[model samples]
Target: MQHSYRQLADLLSKEIRAGRYQVGERLPSVRSYAETHHFSVSTVIRCYRYMESQGLVEARNKSGMFVADWKIQNASADKTTQGKKQPAPPSVEYDKLISLQHRMTELYSLTAQPLHLGLHLASAAPQWYPCEALSKIAQRQLRQQPWQIGDYPTGTGLPALKTGLISWLATCGIDLEPADLLITNGSTEALNVALRAVAQPGDAIIVESPVYFGLLQMIENLGLKAIEIPCVPGAGISLEALEYALEHQTSVRAVVAMPNFQNPLGCAMPEKNKKRLLRLVEQYDLALIEDDVFGDLSHQQERPLAIKAWDKSGRVIYCGSCSKSLAPAFRIGWIAGGRYQSRINSLKLSSSLITPLFEQAVLAEYMQSGALPSHLRKLRERLVANIPLAIAAIQRYFPAGTQVVSPAGGWWLWLELPEHIDSLALLRQAVGKGIAFTPGTLFSSSSKFSHFLRMNIGRPWGREMEQGIKTLGKLAAELHV
Candidate 1:
């Protein structure tokens, strides 16, 4: 059962997530809202308060409720369909992954190579980083508070950073108290800490098929087994597939998912699917460890509400970081452990102690300066232009059946090479030609997606980018024959 405030929050959240309310829009007044909802004045006020708490709306002293720019939109397709249980992917066992571990080593080594035009790395170009902005912030912080750096930071990050994060996260519809957030090195550490808190070694956790290789590495490092549920290109994990897994796999303790701009697949789950995911997790009593590192990178003006924003039961451990959108060097990421805050905090203390306060303060100061939104707006304009250009290049140079996924957010373009082409082998040949790409095998523990590969598109398209893409397309074409 949900509280009345929570219910109203859901309806309003859905509308906001669906982009019914634009950035800087205004919501209905309490009097009108109360009459329309058939609720009393107090109930309406409570609902508004709840909405404000989530960062969805805010109250101006004299004015009524106004929307915040937190939930901006990116490039999500409106198309949605009822999800059917997909055919299960090849199962992964511990021994098999260990044997195939060499692939991980090889993939990482490739990234280290000095490819002048590296298309394999998903990190934003150095030019894209807000180095200048952060440098200014760092300098100001040093001047004002020289003694601040001497203190050993709290295990739960700096107080100001967490406080700023709450208001920032609300834009994405994830409102929380500062205490709920535990900061770590990056989203990786946040994900690592959250997983360790919820599940132990040898426990099985469900991950999306063709998942983020970084998460796959985390699972392997933790000595856990990764189970696969197919994430369709446009649709995310199907309810039927999740239900099947829940019913069949009793040992499955937690399911780690990225609902927004999901890695490798370049897909964002729809609002309806997000609600369904919550229901399934609740019904099965499973932990939903949500990775939302890419939610803010949407190409649209409206931001999608993270699934955590709709979590009423406190089961979603929402992880976020600036590695994707802001400066990666900041190493600032956090997890709002709804019901598992204490457990997450305990794990944080034992593992990393806490991220340095100086870096956290730098980020906090930058956010307060209002530079993040301005930076994202400029970056997104480049992506909107770059995606179509890259897609055009792929179409021009690749074989007939080769396909690419142009997601509304994130920094990569997922390519499904024509059947029978060995992307890994092609990558090997391409590497020597001064080109790079992320092979699909790296994203999976099983044999699936062998004909698939992902290309990094974090920079603007130009001669070098086009030439590198054409060269890779030529290699893919040669292999297809």
Candidate 2:
């Protein structure tokens, strides 16, 4: 199908763009790529053909494929015009530095692998998903006369969905209106839209060190510069460092953060700190983009009030997604822009015509049916049960002196590995045994967490997973020794 081909093309393109492949580098043989990805060789061949058409790569008569040498003279010119002066002649491209150390067939090379415990994948939980219920809703929508899959979600999203979200937020003491909301493909897209709407290329954005890798990737792709402030697990970013950065860095355009159950560190900013941040944002006339993707997944029933709720001047852009709470595949997320709603909406329209309509409709129906609350309750219970199990496993199997952060919410465990062991190297060894996890370095601009790893605690424990953890622990211990 055309859809499948596009997916394959996207997968390959991401890898190539991420610099996993270098110019003139040989690609993995078709058989290897196909086997690793579980795709047919024919599909991979088609993908390769598509890549060739895009000038992303070239095929050799017998040596397989190589990344093409796209001239960056124009890129260099643009960078120069943008005030980026290079010491070198600009003839040296980063593409040349890309490592060809591993076979190009590894998907994990492009993205962080969930923990070996199989506990972190959003798709791992099936019991909490109301699949049949969603199907019924979709069926009902299709049964209508002259059925349409639904129109692309406008900036305001489905009006009913927006209204449902407003009602839902009211229960948490956050009052919002349909006019304040914008629907996005997911939290990732919402963050992308927010970044594009507010930040120009080369603008400085302050981020929590050991933050989410996905956000870091977004910042990199957009050419936005980031300043990192050390963040402690169970506490948020160092306030003094952030304040200093804001005061000294006049070019700083925004503060992007995850105040609740922050990715990788799983740190929740305290209420006082949230207020202090709000005040600072107001004082500096800076925008606050809050990523609350895991807002609903806290093990604690009483969730912290969102920083957006405290924004009086409409400086906060609050983003949330059902992907974390329900299903990542659903890809349903929304943004509440207190004052920047129209700007964000315009950016969304320019980027992607709209979020898919059917998925939004189905999600709206599920919310209206009161299924989401019950699902969250069950999901929270499951995560609470699994978190301790994962912790115990790590304690039992990991190297001595390893530190584990027990988050009050979210399904991630941030592990402080032995100082000498590199998480990336550990990841390399673990993936060789069909195990994977998010390395801590990806979370920061400076890659400060090279000695740490984040384990997903969402999946059920298993023998293979435990064995993998043991192997990793032994490896870490060996490195320590």
Candidate 3:
């Protein structure tokens, strides 16, 4: 029923998503793709252009077509299984995760906490914050209203903060009103509130493979089971696989995702795919929890739109925060609960009561002072600039066949180390050498990612950072079996 060019585009898209092509690798020329597939060059060109518009592939001025970094690497194992439908992932293993957590705790307790360097943490360094400006604002607020700190905060949030967030959300393409928003302690609390609002204990929630560890922890604590769908290199959750899951798994109650600048992976879901995702969720009547904490840290000039931007029926529960982009200690986060506002408010009232009023006031004033845009411009520039330096180090120092993912907009860099090396063992050795990074084993419910790891690229790049990475490389080499 599809047109020939559309059919060809779909076929090539599957190949790219299957790990047949690597990120930053050049695609076959239009002439060659046409000759091999027995299609006209013009048709192939049209297909390529369409894919470009979808953020799948990009055309260089004279260098030919290439896959965008945002759509970078597929799961390495997918290379051999191209065109085959991935089977339903096994139910999330609670015991395995608990053991992994224990091991992480032991590693941390054994290391000298202050002396150990954090290649493990994803937070920006203190120097990166606009401390001088925030200090001035805080002092002025105290001088103007000395009695403000004594008051109990509203259950939902301070009205002024909600109003400011309305304008802020507009920039991200999500139009919201004060009534539609609820402030929380941080994105962590926001996610917890959203999940609790939609799902009950013993329910099944679909999540991405190699998902953020915090979400996995939330699922476990809530006594919910998880079904992970493999993610495509540049695109987000495989809509095909998701639909298949929804068809067979009637117990699935909700799905969680980070569409823009996904954690660990750093890929953005294409706009078309986001729309399709909304439609699919609507078809099956499921709720979608969208985590957009890192959406503001794009390497490019334009910010990508959130999945909630396309939600028409209110099936999407949108969550975001200032924690990653600015003022981490302020603990400012919010949700545009769409259709779930009432239940979310109830949950907010039940847990944590409300976010701090004084902090919210400070954040609101700072957001409105025309200072945030300038700060983010500089922050984004610094974060993006660090990627190449980190990648160069990885390629030069790490053992060959050690694959690293160059994220498009986020601060995290994910690495797929050689199969023989265990990240936990490497972390132990690296910790002994005064460095620490998150082992990939912590990110999933299974042991499949034990050979992987994630590094924070948000920190300022310098000799100390480079040496730490080089040392990690040396340690990885030593651990190879």
Candidate 4:
């Protein structure tokens, strides 16, 4: 638990990084700061001294402390802001992607230990879930709305869920009406609906390179092609590359994006790109399907503004979900489908009929209450805590020339192995040793990411988990050799 002194120092450190205190600017004296914050002078001194130790500030013999000339280590936004001329969209080999489906179909019948794709989520520990509070809220919802369970559900969803979503999203700077949103079974189904509403057979859908496998599967199943746009780890998908695709690819129906805590890559698009994406949608007279299920799981409580927040012409289809942050079993997800709301609503009704009313009502109540923030705080704390341990393990055990990206948020780490090593082969060896990681080939429609792997670091730092990672590293090293 953070004590008063640590909290004070943390807040000050944030302000400094945000440019509230410029480099070399003198900090207020311990007595003045203590009086202003209603803290003891000793507490204030401790806070300053801690900041000094962290290299956020410095002190001289006769002078007061000053803001240190430090480069903040977690500037994920700044890393990928540069423009690049993207290469032409490459031919994708869907062989590995098809094999993944075959394995899943045979998953249950397999005699040996099933390869855990690690997608079922082990990052948010049981201690973090507000089970008791949620149980009470769920019980109360059932008590209050006994009739809702049996009633023919509304075409969209429970009004209360949409209202709660609107309120929650406002905290992230997006506005939506109930009519603007359609609740689906989960973000996966929401993506299905969005894809159905936006694209037809043989249409091209632009997606980030090394995209989410689920989206790739849906695109292939729907007989749609994906135009892969390259994404840099810290920055995001190249805006220039997207512009090139929009200009050249006339058959492209919609662009799918995950601006916040993107899957596999685990990066956020800078705010400038978010706005630029909106402009691109307008310029091409095309549409965007945004997947932001992981938006709420950012390391910081203050989320970056979503791409949909900039849409004015009803061209952006914004998808959100409670699966990653809240209870996954609840299966609550929704889409704000701009101009495509009617089609998406029709697809949702035809696809799943209606989301569970009890789940919707309970989630609505839980989010409106104070419990949501507290649950998110604990979840992010655990997720942020696990990232470094996994990174350190990879660096320590993995072969030379291995690279790992420090994600700005979320639980997965993307590792770029030596070029000679095939991640899919590594996956085969890893499963034998009881370690399961998603191969990079699964993330893309093409074989471009054959040398990459996405490791699930959602599980806490423990001997078993660390050893599993070490074993994974050992397996990869053997493959490299």
lDDT string, candidate 1, 69-153, tens digits = 5533111112322332222111111112233455776666666766777778767787887888789888887899888878766
Score candidate 3 by TM-score against the native. Answer: 0.79
> Candidate 2 — which residues are off by over 4 angstroms?
1-107, 110-124, 144-146, 150-155, 462-464
Question: Candidate 3 local accuracy as lDDT?
Answer: 0.82
Model 3 error, position 200 (Å) = 1.0
Report residue 270 deviation for candidate 4 (angstroms): 0.9
The alpha-carbon lDDT assigned to residue 453 of candidate 3 equals 92
Q: For candidate 4, lDDT tens digit of each residue in 294-408?
A: 8888997787888888888889998988877887778788899999999988888887888878888888888778678878888888989888888899999999999998898
Tens-digit lDDT string for candidate 3 (1-481): 8878888989988988888887788988766788899997657766876776656676553256787653322333346546433321111221133344554554466454654468777688877888788889999999999889887776688898888888878887888888899999899999998889888998999998879988888888888888999889888789899999999998898999999988889998899999998888898889999999999998898899988887888889999898888888888899888899999998889888888889888888988887888999999999989999999999989988999888888888899999867777677667768888888888887888878999887888899988989999998888664
Error of 1 at 319 (Å): 0.4
Best by lDDT: 3
Candidate 2 lDDT tens digits, 199-277: 8999988898877767777887798987887786577877888899887898888899889988877778899999998
Would you list the C-alpha lDDT of every candidate in the order shown?
Answer: 0.80, 0.74, 0.82, 0.78
Candidates in descending TM-score order: 3, 1, 4, 2
**Model 1, residue 458: what's the lDDT?**
89
RMSD of each: 25.1, 13.5, 19.2, 24.3
